[model samples]
Target chain A: MKPIQLQLKQISYSYNGEKQVLKNVNLDISQGEKIAILGANGAGKSTLFTCMNGVITPDSGEIVIEGKKITKKNKIELTKKVAFVFQQPDNQIIAPTVLSEISFGAMNLKLPQEQVLKRVYEAMEYMNLKTFENRTTHTLSGGEKKRVTIADSIVMQPHIYLFDEPTTALDPLHQQMLEEVLEKLSQQGKTILLSTHDVDFAYRFAQRVIVFYKGEIIADDTAETVFCNNKVLSMSNLKQPILLQIQHILMQKGLLKQCNIFAKNIQQFQKLI
Target chain B: MEKHFEQIDYFAYHSPFRKYSAMSKFIFTMTLLLLCLYFNNIAISCYIIVTMLLINVLKNNIKLYDYIVMLSIPFVFVFFGCIAIAIEIHFENHIIIYVTKQTVLKSICVMARTFGAVSILYFFTLSTPIYQMVFVFQKLHIPKILTELMYITYRYLFILIEIQHQIKIAAISRLGYCDIKTSLKTFSSCIANLFILSLKKAQKHYQAMEARCYTGELLFLQEKQYYNKTTTIKATLYILSILLLKIVLRGQAL
Candidate 1:
């Protein structure tokens, strides 16, 4: 098994000492693992992501990245290891122009100007934002702004990324672009944890699925196992991915042979057919 | 408010003079403004105003109507200010108000100076983008906190305006502004809601910044712009002419 890149040990949190938001949740994430955290609204997904990125310290327990426990003194180093992309690009974009916005994080790291510019240009190119370098952040279209936020995260070059509902408010084209970017990041061995309501995207993109129900982890396993588990689905109020439903129906009708490995996406299912 | 802001920003970014170094442009505008203030002479002020007007209209390609509209906003205040200077009121057995030649000349002088100064500012704002000005500020070693605040405030101003626009549209669709009483209530409620929404957004913005490793500094990468020789030469010539015009027209009035 691959070495663990991030470990959350019995983490728990609450807002203003009131109701629990994260209830003694524990998770171990390996390097380059694509994880989709599935949950309904107010299910603690965003809170958990913020905790991991050190934006909000867990009320109890600790988070370790690369064997180093995160602390107030070393939170800056944790920032270097983990990057968080907010759902609202408007909130995340602090700089006036795209070039400056993308370089904001790298510059905060106090990297040399040349290195910062190099990383910014490379990230922009990767995200297809080359033409948008000087465009005002406010003037960009919804999809364009989404890419800018992802590019901003990319310039940080962190090993782990925590994205909060990345696909929310995105058009189909931009969503596809985001998917491609995530795939490339995973290929580059970056650990990714994204909270999303898109079941089909989660099924195709994530190697591991985590179901959060009422501030607790009800299920943690492979996508096939978690999505196929009826109890987990009912408790989390999540529906099966359409592809998964179709696959199950085919098997019930004896139109397809039963196999231990399920196809992750439509292309694979087509090959099976 | 949002439309006006967008139009100015659009012109600033699209202006032909944007190609020049912001430092050079800023220095040119400040020099003209200071000289105009020092001289306080109508000829020199008029010269400055005409030069800026030509640059904005001819070179910057700004529409004449738009330029007039923008200039008129500040001019209205100046005009009202000049009125106070140009006339004197006396209280005796009967109230008396009068305008003298000396007072009229003084008021015209003040008006000229203000127009000249405003024209210089308009040229700078209409031609230089905000990012370029921020770069200039950074180069001048302005305090980081101030520049950071400027950046954040400028970024959010558009967002707040957009929110206000959306709320106004929704209220209109719901007939919330169908009458005077309803309109006043709707406007006040919109202001209240905008305040609360902005505060929440500000908190989220700060958290977002912290998540990206923002310790205390907000750093950005600016494209290095070398001052073009021709542009620098032109700006120098313009500054010298303004000074020469002031010297020639010293103590002169319209």
Candidate 2:
């Protein structure tokens, strides 16, 4: 079995001592796991991510990365291993130019200059941002800016990647590109976690799904199991993926066999049909 | 109007002068600005203004009309400012306003000096990108706090402008600016809302930065900018010619 990459122990957080945002949350993320967090707005998904990334220290529990407990003294070191891509590219981008923006995190690591530039260029090539090196960050289109922010995190070469609503403002084409980027990261043996409202995307992309509802984890299991749980879906106010809905209807009509595993994407569905 | 603001940055990225070192440009502009003021002569001031404007337009490919429109923003302020210097006011029971020959000439000199200084600064900004200027400032040993403030302020200006644009659109769609009274009320409300929104955005931005491991310093790789000997030589010759022109035109009246 893969070793646990990150473990959260009864973590809870609140803003300004008001309205507990995350309550007694516990999670064990294995290495190279592709997990999608499904939640409504203000469901504590973002708060959980920030807590894991060391941006917000949990009010009550503890977070351990690679068996190393994160504390105030070593928080920076532990945080360097986790990259959090913000939902808004504008807020994440600190530098004016694309080259500097992507290199901001890598440079912060105090790495050699050559290594920093090499990582930046490699990430840019991977993200197809070679031509946009010197372009002003604000002048970029919404999709392009999103890619830059992803590249910014990629340059850090973190072990775990957390994306907060990565597809919120992306168009279909850009969304496809982001899926490819996520696939590449997963293939590189990095743990990936993203919070999203797109159930269809989560259905096709994530191997595991975690549902957050009102500062509590309602469901955490394989995508097939979580989506098949009607209670979890209703509690989170999330609808089942369209493909899963079709599969269920077919099974109810006695046209399809009930199986433990089901097709999660269009290609698999077509083959099954 | 937003297009005009964006065009300044667009041209800076594409301008031929972008290849030159920002430090060199800064020094050159500052020297010319000081000389323009110290000489305080009309011919020298006009010479500085015309040359800077011509170079920006001809080399940078900026449209003459657009450049004038941008410059007119400062021209309005300078014009009104010159009026105060041009006229003399006297109070004897009632107020009396009069213009003397000396005051008129003095106001023209002040106007010339202001235009010369402004044009030289424009040449620098129209060619060098803001980040490059910030890099130069860092190299000059500016306080880290000041540099950080400068950079964030420059970046947030665009974000704030974009938010303002969206808010204005929403207001227009709701008929919030239909009449004078309504427009005044809407404008005040917009300002109030903008302040709150900006604060929220600032906090979010700081959080985002912290997530990336920002401790105290804003660090990034500065690309090496090499100075070209030819550009330096040309800049030097330009300064010499301006000084010679000032000396020869000291007593001349325009």
Q: Candidate 2: lDDT of B98? A: 95
Once superposed on the true structure, which residue ranges of model 1 sit more than 4 Å away at CA? Answer: B247-254
For the candidates in turn, chain A alone yields TM-scores of 0.98, 0.98
Q: Tell me the DockQ of each model, to 2 decimals.
A: 0.82, 0.73
Q: What would the per-residue lDDT of candidate 2 be over residues B1-254, giving only the tens digit for each residue? A: 76777788888878888878899999998899889888888888899889988888897788888788888989999999999999999999999999999999999999999999999888998989888999889989999899888889878889988998899899989999999999999999998999999898888888888888888789887655669999899889999999899777767765
Top of the candidates by TM-score: 1
* Per-residue lDDT of B77 in model 2: 98
lDDT of 1 by residue, A67-150 (tens): 998888897777788999999988888888999999999998899999999999999999999998878888998889889999
Quality class of the docking in candidate 2, CAPRI style: medium
Best by DockQ: 1
Name the runs in model 2 displaced over 4 angstroms: B1-4, B89-98, B223-226, B250-254
Q: Taking the tens digit of each residue's C-alpha lDDT, what string does model 2 give over A1-273?
A: 899989999999999999999999999999999999998899999999999999999999989999999888899866799999999998888788899888889888889999999999999999999999888888899999999999988998999999999999899999999999999999999999999999999999999999999899999999999999999998888999999999989989988888766899989988777
